[model samples]
Target chain A: MMPLWVGPVARYMATGLVTTLALAVVSIAVSVVLGTLLGALLVLPSRAVRLAVRCYVEIWRGLPIIVTLFFIFFVLPVIGLRFDTFVAAAIGLCLWGSANVAEVVRGAVQSVPRGQADAAAALGFPWRQRMRYVVFPQAVRRAVPPLVGLVVNLTQQTSLATVIGVLDLLQASQRSIERLTLSSGATHAVPILGAVLVVYFVICLPLTSLSRRLERSLQRA
Target chain B: MTAVDFEPGFVFSHLGPLGQGLARTLAISAVGTAGALAVGGLLGAASALRIPVVRQVIGAYVEVFRNTPLLVQIFFLYFALPEAGVKLSAFTVGWLSLVLWGGAYNAENFRAGFEAVDPKYVEACRALGFSELASFRRVVLPLGTRTALPSVTNTLISVFKNSSFMIAIGYPELTDTAVDIVSVTFRAFEVFIAIGVVYLGLVWIFSLGAGLIERRFAIPGGH
Candidate 1:
């Protein structure tokens, strides 16, 4: 049979899980779109643009995600840019996630053989058509596995929103532990946090395995 | 509310605490890297040797740790373990989590390296009548470690970066130090930017050192 705390804790955590999913979904979607743009810009002929994109990617990716979130949530208000906790966390995550995805995209695009681009040029295709018809399709195949890995990482990282008090899965479990301990006078951290761990494991393990499988197949190809 | 003026130099005035925090971060990262290497090396070698149930156990360990976030693992170690009567200090929990997480990734890195060791070398060692242990120590160890160096270096850098997560449980690392200063001074921009630069510098130095070692130990005529 189930314990009394199970029902209440699950109910509380379900709401938190929804928030976590929303944050992850928004961050992932925005980052992928922005990062792909930054990545394409990284390969442009203009040295200044490439350098600017490089700095953005390096700076954001180098900082800890927590610091990024804190800077957004805590510091931005000092400069008159106020954001809600959820919005702040989402923006912070997008900055960091996009930087990582940008690197992956850059690497994937560069990995495509130079000969592919030259062949398209030889066929009298313009630069846009060459990249559109020839390069991106091949690059997309190479990029998929790493992109999936990034999604896994971004999902796991959404838990960090708890630090900024975003009521994520981890935060909800913390609240549950507190309420249960207060009422029952015994630590219920194990079951609640254990459930939290299981939740994350369930969400991430399949993606991780899928990424590995894709990587293996890519290597064989 | 009145406009909050940006004080870009505010963090510079509190260099003492930030320096202490830097030391703590470096110390924890150093110790964690060593522990991770030891644990990962052993587990990876065991997996390479294919020791019955041990291999499966190591596989499971790698998957579970890799699949979960480092933050949650830290919470489990800090918050959950105490319920089982295994109370540990926050500092203990900080580096322990890094070691555990980094060790898992490193195990996978080392296993791939060991598996990539060309079989002809093993055959050559065997034809010379060397025992399994000696051959592993002599030939496979050197070559495998070379192949593993790139990925292992990545995990090591991640260990340094992840030490920032210690702030959640208040371990007084660099991020924690910055947070404390921010609370008192309200100079979030300066504090976060300063610490971000520090972390980037640390990562840069680490990668540079790793690159040097990679060059020094590079296998002749092998990519």
Candidate 2:
């Protein structure tokens, strides 16, 4: 049987879908920049910088996403660090994605041939210019496929943001259930949840397939 | 509302009650991960057999699990399924949700592991007249397990961390405990910090164990 929650199903799905996309895009943008920098510094000549970055990534990655969400959402306000739900969620996700992305970036960057760095050095090119022209370009190319996969994962992680009342997709579904149950004493879980799943599939399928294809194409090349 | 006072013993005292929740979290995570391994392994094995029917079914399972968020899965199972004569205890829904969700992802890992095993080993085993089971156990497994170690560990870490989704379904895990403490004591910072610290400790311990496993099955970096 179709859900009675069908009344608000479209509205809930549309709201949740847009919120998910916003979270994914903002989180990805923040993390990619921070991750790239963190990764580069981790490979820097200075031991302390590498060690510090390593610790930061390790600390963030080791904690559960929910714990991070709670820490940012609840704890921040205690110390006078207030944020709206969106900002809090975005920061939590950015921190988590950055840790993983940094590792991915470092792995890709290190995979680039040492000879390229040697050639750059022989030409008296400064390190920044060489990394920009010679190294980062190749690393970035190799990193794109995996980074795409990371973004897909991050999209799913945004569901955690609802804990702090962001009213994202999951929350929207829950609200529909609550309202419907209260009004009619009947819940339309099937259609409501089914609709939510369909939305996610439509959003995620392309990215997932693209990454897989890129992995194959990259391997062949 | 006046922010509640940060009395010292009250927060610490709640730890006694909170231990039950923490234990539940650990148990749920362990059960969920074990269920994922079994379900994922079967699906992976079936899909890898190249049977069209099994492949199609497993593909759909993977799609449903992979595309949606775990929180939604838990909520659907916990809150919605009851109306359909598929009632579950909160704990049951929590564990089953993770099993269903994590199984899909882990199946992909297993399939990848199955694919990367050397063909020559299987050919040699076949030439020697070993049973398929024997060959899979002796040859394909050793190599595939090594290749799969890093990804498996990665999934394990995820399964452990994702355990916190139980909060949505009201399973009363660490995250929920932190919230409760914050509500009661108004020491949001301390409570949240404590929650993060505990999760970090647990995950660190898990990583240490995984690192040891990875080291045991060290392979060439080419893959």
Candidate 3:
């Protein structure tokens, strides 16, 4: 793929690609866990917890990821907290991902048939046990496709981390473009950004298609 | 490009500038979503009217937008297309890009709406000697509009959210302006929270407005 484009630029992109994946993978893990907790918190019987969770999800979803990234990158250091670029990128992506996941979780939980929960309760299954043992497993299955789609989105959102000087794929291309086209007249933007696009496409397309496949499979089931 | 250390008083002093960006954010999203709904409805209806050429053209356009990332689409409009001789402000590029991208998604919503219109109604109109346009206007459009609302609300919310990307190309929108302030002050948490609160407040207002409209329009005992 690098040879198909430009060797040196492609090589730089390949190296920078690691930073992107790190942001994506760590961000995804943290988000899913946070989302699950937030989702569960919202569905709790306590009105206060539910209200708080609902508010958190709503506020996060409405806000833009770019805005959040800026906040993460620029804000914390002023409050006597400083995280490096990678950590900031991870935290920013995590915060954004969690909100989307919470929505997916909420939808999936609702999608579970009413009878299953009722039946589980009738059989003397405790509420906590029922959710943990019965309802959640099924909801997770239903949630997978949308969750995948959310991840695909999250993957793209990670590109915004480049704005914080993270040196992810997009930032790498920006750097090379500055060097090649603008600065030295030796490097190029089209190939670099174009190459970044394909790398992104390669990373994202499979997950998106997989999400579709899962949806179809579930439909068939 | 100036990065600074975070401090307490920074966000308070800059809060005034940030509030102005929120107005721009709302304006861009509202105008863009409205434009998208209009274009999407027309395209969706045209595609479904059994006009082969029109259907093909609309279908292809939708496919192109739906498959690509919105950032690339925005970049193409803001940077690339201008080189092709059409110059537009960054804001115009932002608005038009969302309108195009969101409209494609909206078209699908409207297409589903069109399909959901009971064919029996169309047939009944035919029996009553209603013209095709009359039947569509009186019967089809109303039902389609109602059926399309909930789905389009999703797109509407998304249009608002994605409009933030307009900041990337220097659209002077709320998010972009916030980034500038945060970059200068390095007060990340406060500015982020401030932006989040503004967004939450707006979305709440939107949801409240949506509820009012839904209630006003809801059919008694209607799904």
Say which candidate scores most in lDDT: 1
**What are the lDDT scores of the predictions, listed in order?**
0.91, 0.82, 0.78
> What count of clashes does model 1 give?
0
Rank list by lDDT: 1, 2, 3
Residue pairs in clash, model 1: none
How good is chain A of candidate 1, measured by TM-score?
A: 0.97
Off by over 4 Å in 3: A1-5, A132-134, A183-206, A209-221, B1-16, B48-53, B82-86, B116-140, B187-190
Off by over 4 Å in 2: A1-7, A119-126, B1-11, B131-134, B219-223
**Ten consecutive residues with minimal summed lDDT in candidate 1 chain B?**
B3-12
Second chain alone, TM-score for each candidate: 0.95, 0.89, 0.90
Estimate candidate 2's alpha-carbon lDDT, on a 0 to 1 scale. 0.82
* CAPRI-style docking class of model 1 based on DockQ: medium
Query: lDDT at B92 for candidate 3?
Result: 87
lDDT for A48 (candidate 1): 99
Q: For residues A26-94, write the lDDT of model 3, one tens digit per residue.
A: 989899999988987777789998888887787677777777777766756665587998898788778
Q: Per-residue lDDT for B1-223 in model 3, tens only?
A: 4555445566778867777787888788988999899988999888656578888889878766665567756755655454456878987887898899889989878887777788999999999999988898888888877777777777877888888888878887888887777667555666777777777677778777877776676545666
Task: Tell me how far the alpha carbon of residue A185 in candidate 3 is from the true structure, in angstroms, after superposition.
Answer: 5.2
Query: By the lDDT metric, which is better: model 1 or model 2?
Result: 1
In terms of lDDT, the poorest run of 10 residues in model 1 chain A is A74-83
